[model samples]
Target: MTLETDDRAEAQPTARPSRLARVRAGLPRTGLAALCGALLALSFPSFGIWPLSIVAVTGLALLTYRRTLKQAAWTGIVFGGVFMFWLLIWIDVIGYDAWVLLALAEAAFVMLMAMGQAAVSRLPAWPLWTACLWVTQEWARDRVPLGGLPWGRLAFANTSSPFTPLAALGGAPLVTFAVALSGALLAAAILALRARGRRAGVACAAGAVALGVVGYAVPLPTGGDTAGGPASAEIALIQGNVPHAGMDFLGRPMQVLGNHVAATEALMAKVGEGKLPQPQLVIWPENSSDVDPYVTPEAYQLIDGAAKQAGVPILVGALVDGPDATHVMNEGIVWDPKTGPGAHYTKQHLVPFGEYVPFRSFLSQYISELKRVAVDFSPGDKTGVLQVGPAKIGDVICFEVAYDGIVRDAVTKGGRVIVIQTNNATYEHTDQPDQQFAMSRLRAVEHGRSVVIAATSGISAVIAPNGSVIERTQLATQAELEANVPLRDGLTLADRVGATPEWALALLGLAACGFAVWQRRRQPK
Candidate 1:
């Protein structure tokens, strides 16, 4: 009887250890997922540890491998929540609640993406499918929940990385795919190494290395005098200081306008002294004139005087009175030295709560913040490829730079150079400006056009066609930057292909998920 009791006690101890071992295994995966998310956030601007993004991706792939769909969903929640909350901490400037809600909303999509990725993990060529899944998530997120928030794409993180030139071939979607595939390949290598399959591990490692270095071979043409070739235009970017940061950035109505006018006048003064070369055109930040230049005579005179002083056209961003009393328009007007305001490009994509609150009556009842945007800003029907003096420039205002279709429309519609007119005052002293600036660099390489950014409260910059920053300004400072930028007319492969690659890759990912479901159902339960 004593011998029997000893056997039973030993069996009980073994059972306890089995449960403990399973719990211990799960704890590491959860912790690793959170760590990976933080690493991915660090890959973005401000920290800019880019290689960490690949490492994070590898960690996620390994953690999710062979996971149950439910388990993968939990992993996604942990990873997405941490990464998005970190990346969008700038939204806390509005409210902590707003920041949390936005991060969670974005994370829900990542959860769905993770479920799809798990489904495909059992399929052959899963690394390719996993890469496609990343594009699929981005494509969907770029268009939903009120025109989507595209702040944390993989392509944005790789703006200056070797993966950037792939953007010239297939736009942002391809760059994202390349980054994801490289990381997934690395994960495959790791799995092979753990299994003692040395040959397989070496092959996977080689593929990842090949993918990382392939962008160096892509030819990015920057047609200019520097290349001893075609057209180039000398342009000036003006960044005017704002009164303060936060929601009340445009203090005292005309104060912001005066700041910009003073900066432009100073720029022309330098030209008069021969200290700076004369520019063919001057670009001003969005909200340079908060008052309607067309309706307000003082605003008109202020802009006209600056253009006259510069002896060139000024792309003036203004808040114009709309057709009705309750609405306004965000427009970029071409104010020529002689012609005055001509050929204006109104902002097409309007910010939901920031520009015009959606479901205003319902949402405003709960959130008092909706009351700030009293007048709804109307959207423009046309693209912003306007003739600004000597150059046919694409005018992408503020957050419009984040949209693929908006920027592509301008490039396809005969824009020789791209000008991003933005106001970073509201998001000053945050990583938001740096993040947006990185997008401009990617856009420059994507469309193969010189990108000129003009920002209020700073980070205004001139980026070359090769994704190089020619000139930039300090945040919240009154500064003027001039760069003789290339004006390229030739269309890049990305421009010509448009959204084809994104669509193809996205569809393929969905198909893989469908196949994975079918495969699972066919299995013996």
Candidate 2:
């Protein structure tokens, strides 16, 4: 058991370790850090998200075995920095300077989380301290400097893991805790392996195995799990490749529509040629139909004809002028083959510099391309569900999949299938799709709902509730994905709690830090 130290004493600087000693204690090996990140990325994309996370976190913890709080922080920071630098390579597609700054901020946030954990090194329960520190940092990063960037989040590790069911309990937070704890136990096992006592090794092995066992016992329930009944509905995702991925192509609405028009015609030809299966509902990605369908009669007629020809419903990612003229909604409109148009869901979350500039009047003048390209499209009410065939679908436009609670609530409102229609054409990120794909997989685990992702320029896919990719198109290409989606009915415990994992960790971490500071303050001079 560890006794809390005085805050004053805790603040005092002690004699620092020599460079070689620090190295031995895992004080940031540039090579190892970079290698760890690459491994993490590699294990993902194909191997699933767990092994990489388990290895990365466990390795970091071992690196800090005999190190001080400061040195431990360095280890975590270096590891996180390298991971984000590669993981977020797509950001470079938009621009260099701004994204680089964003990466720095993101890395700093992760490092701070690590530092917080390091500060609690003397705690009796090191694993618990590590968890608290990590949780604390996650919350801070979510709120700091404007809103927050929740990219490269830890919960993504279990996206393909058997432990994915845990997301239903507390969203990503539960997953993060379990994964970290698994890593912590692994670190303990490593320590036990080197120990002279066989009992210690046995205990560590038992603990690690217990974590895995517990994860397995807590089975996840998919939204489809509680579905009133089971039936398959055919769906289509349209990929309208943009002229180019450059921001310079903005204001060219005609060109944007033209690209989509060409693609839709090709898809129709496939249907006639019997090259593609008949779809019950056709899904177009965000901005795939940015021109208001209500106003663009020809576009509406074109889509209507296709839907009638296919004899199905079509959920189109479109732009809608606000009712009061105060804003224009980045909207998702449901157009039935017979009904023309019915319900709609607007995009609630907006991307900075991409969708619209922050404080367009002030920030707009700073980023020249942003002024020309990024529109002042307002967020839509996501509460509304689009009627598709016999199913009521929720539309998660673009990166909205990144927001956990929002998607959960949609499912709560009886959203049978969550469809994300997005255009990744602007950011020709080679790795961006992989990162985005990873997040979507986790979403499947959390909500237990089938997800249909349609992206312009490639990587359009259909994901099953188990977080497995069913089918996907190649990148930088135009293709049509036609698949049957299962209707989802029930909500998980996590669906109700919404990202509780990071929140719980952040709260406890803060309390621990406060306690540590208090103890140090009370220490004698």
Q: Using TM-score as the measure, which candidate wins?
A: 1
lDDT of each: 0.89, 0.69
Clashes of 1: 0
Instruction: Pick the lDDT winner.
Output: 1
Model 2 misses residue 208 by how many Å?
Answer: 2.8
Error of 1 at 321 (Å): 1.1
Candidate 2 TM-score versus the reference: 0.85
Candidate 1 positional error at 266, Å: 0.6
Q: Model 2, range 1-525, lDDT digits (tens) per residue?
A: 111234466568999889897566442354565566666556555445567787877766666544555655666667777777766766765566556667778888767666555555545667777766666666677666655766766676567675576776777777777777777777767666665566876776677567666756766543343346555677788877776765543237646655665676777789889988777778877777657778878767776775676677777777777654655787777878888888888888777766666777876566555555444667765474667776677778777777765677778887888887777776654666666777887887777778888886767899887677889988777778887777777776677666556676778887776775566457677
Model 1 residue 445 distance off true place after TM-score fit, in angstroms = 0.6
**lDDT per residue as tens, model 1, 372-449:** 778899999999998887788899999999999999999998888899999988889899999999999999999999
Q: Candidate 1: which stretches are off by over 4 Å?
A: 1-25, 225-230
